[model samples]
Target: MDKIVLKNMAFYGYHGNLESEKSQGQRFFVDVEIKTDLTKPGQTDVLEDSINYVEVYDMVASIMTGESCNLLEHVGALIADSLYQHFQGIIGLSVAVRKPSVPIAGVLDYVEVVTTRGQI
Candidate 1:
């Protein structure tokens, strides 16, 4: 199996448990790791032979910016499900959703939820 990884794709979304979070929104970072066989694309050197990066990015962007979710876990699941539905060549995939502006009492960098689907 081969891999296609997209990292630190940032978006502004209203996704959190708190009221302020839902209203004000915050920055979210998503990282996706797609598992697939790259042999066809590697050999053909054609865009059609592989998963389109622009399409994947657009899909993620739509999901992240469109709806309001309560948990990062749900956001991660949405991305995984959307990818699986749209891309048939994917053997498996993982999505990591990061929330940097958390309402925690203590200071920290960020909170991230990771979800995986299929073989991955």
Candidate 2:
């Protein structure tokens, strides 16, 4: 079980339960881990034998740019689903979406939602 981790991919998007949050938008971070067999790629050193992570990043970026969700959970779930569908080689996946400046008045680093699918 090998894994490819994409961490701290940042984006600016409008996603929140509040109308002001949605209209104003905020910086979001996305982290994703993809589990798959890396034996072939490791042995042959061929790009085709392994997943193209650039494509993965592009896919994530596209999703964030194209859609709007009210909750981090929903965004995370959609990312997990889309990754699973787009990459047949992935046996498992996890996606985490973080909203740093949530409108709550309390002092906190960020709010995050994680979504996982397939055989964890």
Which residue pairs collide in model 1, if any? none
Give per-residue CA lDDT, model 1, range 16-87, as digits (tens): 999999999999999999999999999999999999978999999999998899989899999999999999
> Model 2 Cα RMSD, Å?
1.0
lDDT of each: 0.94, 0.89
Give candidate 2 misplaced runs (Cα > 4 Å): none
- How many residue pairs clash in all the candidates, one count each? 0, 0
Across 1-120, the per-residue lDDT of candidate 2 in tens digits comes to 899999999998888899987788888999999999999999999998998999999988987766678888888888899889988789999998989998888999999998999876
TM-score, structure 2 vs. true: 0.95
Quote the lDDT for 33 in model 1.
94
Candidate 1, RMSD to the unseen true structure: 0.7
Cα distance off (Å), candidate 2, residue 4: 0.4
Angstrom error at residue 11, model 1: 0.3
Off by over 4 Å in 1: none
